[model samples]
Target: MNHETKRDVFEGLVEELANAYIALDGEGIGEELTNEEKQAYMKDYDAALPDDLPVIPELIGKYLIMRKHDRGDLVQALDEGTSFLLDGTQWESVQDWFWFSDVKDSVDTFARAWVLGVWRVEETGEIVKLEEEK
Candidate 1:
């Protein structure tokens, strides 16, 4: 997909996420949210529908969609070396992520790219690619 299209999807996801976050924060879920709750909330708010389109709302969901196929359990696809569709274009740190304001927003960009099924592994060992739905 083109850059503008990817960006649009990412922005939409961010808006959905923002709304969900507000809802959870309003419900005080964040104060004592379990891992399942967090994950569910994340999916509910952030997960794109089957289509590669994001819901366009007042605000967009802005978070990281980490590399799916990684050596970590957070991303099962990466761990198993399987290709998955992003549905939308953006990803947050699905497994483990820490937020720091000092560095460049590479993490953010990476997340966005993740949604678009774009990722770069420092070392070339196995191959991960994007395959659109048939």
Candidate 2:
């Protein structure tokens, strides 16, 4: 796939993941939330996600590999420059590297930090802690 196509796919995946997270967060409190309250919550959640996230090539490659594994579509992933399909060793390697690596840890950390109003600097990718409102 081209760079633009990859970016679109990555963005769609991010949106899907964010919506799922929002839905999961609201699960038990759904009944208590008014329409305006839910809208505000969604707005906040959207704002928490960085709009200027650079499309990290490694992350996008891993995402495509995961999608190929899940959907059994080797051709598409290979077309996008993934080497092997999810065979035994390749599957284990992909799982270990993608799911258990520092990349995942960083993502988890970012999400946790975002909940506390910390954000990443788009240009430098530095983590900044936001001051709490009185």
Candidate 3:
């Protein structure tokens, strides 16, 4: 999908998740959900997604990773191309991936690959660059 279309679909999925979360239990007078119960609700929401929308794996993975690491800012930064995740080898391969390949005038390494920046976290929890944006 194109950037705008992909973003619209993602937003729709997010809205669905949000609505499901709120509807899991009607707003209570005093009974609040425990953390575990909240997680269980999210799991159910995930399981209930229709099987036909398999492309949503990336969106779900992104959300789960960011949530696990408490990295909302990082997600925004990555979206803005201010951060990078792949190493040189992986970056080269990704240029062939549809996300880049489907873009207008996007180039592969055979000519000059347009690097899409994403942040990489090392084992030491250090954020590092995968490539310089050309």
Candidate 4:
């Protein structure tokens, strides 16, 4: 995607995350939230849904339409040019990743990659490649 679209997608993702968090917070499933707080959170969340908020419906469903395949977020959400299609694809980003038997599968070490960003696979090895907004 072009920089403009990528920028839009990135911003959209931020909003999407905010809405999700707000909903979860509004649920007040934790013991920390007071009744008033829950009410206030829900009030704001509901009020924004129908507002002039930009809802990228395509993203509202699924950001990528590519065929089913392995996917993950790794340690955190990746930015532009970091994530790509297919499993183990990210290993290509790491020069020495081939040393590990399952570089594409998991990283037991607390690794850091300046170019690819820092991450370690907790359960299973994944490229953490999710489809980008195309």
Candidate 5:
């Protein structure tokens, strides 16, 4: 699927999951949920999501490496040393590069990188570069 379509699907899935979670009861799996339980669950979920979540485009399930092109930047080399994976909610290092030791800073920090390529799996289960698919 195209990036936009994939993004839409992913967002729909997230909404569905959130709704399902909210509908679940605190006691039995199928019982009616209390308002307190729903509130608590929503609080935790909202806390986990980043404040800048909307700025994150449809990069879910993508693996990538980015390099800064600006020549005047002194930390360019360090920025290019690690690969990253964006799993909907957060950005994580694919390698042990220690760039994002603080979980809160990882997503916003990675967003600043100049993306070299995005790798995603096809419907047939083969992984390919997004550019090559075009």
Candidate 6:
């Protein structure tokens, strides 16, 4: 999807999740949910969409691409540039994957690859580099 489309989808997912959390018990209480529960909630939340989400395995591909670049493997990086994750949310140094700066900016490479991003909705999603951001 294009930048605006992706942003809209992302925002829509967030809003839908919020609505689902609120509507679940009709008490507007938010609770910790597993990634699976969250996605399932989204499907029911946005009944029009019918639970069409990318599989979590896609994140592995993005991680591998980032790992190649992190290791100074330019050729591999270039080959995978078209479909890699490189937002501040996913990687720390464009070449390195870091979970986030919340923990003294220390990187747990394994965690980075496994946990996805700062935001749950965009966890396994690709980064959309818009012209303004670039």
Which model scores highest in TM-score? 1
What lDDT does each candidate get? Answer: 0.38, 0.44, 0.35, 0.32, 0.39, 0.41
Q: Write the per-residue lDDT of candidate 1 for residues 44-123, one digit (tens) a residue.
A: 54443333322211111122222332323324422332323355633343222223323245345444445655333323
Q: Which pairs in model 6 have colliding backbones?
A: none
Clashes of each: 17, 0, 4, 2, 0, 0
Off by over 4 Å in 3: 1-47, 54-70, 73-78, 81-99, 103-134
Residue 47 lDDT (model 3): 35
Q: What range of 10 consecutive residues in model 6 has the weakest lDDT sum?
A: 48-57
* Best-to-worst ranking by lDDT: 2, 6, 5, 1, 3, 4
Give the per-residue lDDT digits (tens) of candidate 3, residues 4-36.
Answer: 233445566577567667766555433445788
lDDT of candidate 6 over 14-121, digit per residue (tens): 876787687667565556567997786556444332122222233444554455436634344434433443443343233332333233332333234323321122
The TM-score of candidate 2 is 0.21
Error of 6 at 13 (Å): 1.7
In angstroms, how far off is 16's CA in candidate 4? 0.3
Per-residue lDDT value at 16 in model 4: 55
* TM-score of candidate 4 relative to the true fold: 0.18
Cα-based TM-score, every candidate:
0.23, 0.21, 0.22, 0.18, 0.21, 0.19
Stretches off by above 4 angstroms in model 6 are 1-4, 24-33, 37-134
Model 4 lDDT, residue 132, Cα: 36
Worst 10 residues of 4 by lDDT: 52-61
lDDT of 5 by residue, 1-134 (tens): 23323444446547756786777787644444588866755655543322222221233223333232223232543454354434444444433323434344444443433232333232343323324322
Model 4 Cα lDDT, one tens digit per residue, 25-123? 555532345678667555554433212112211211121222222243423322221334343333232223323334342232212221122122334
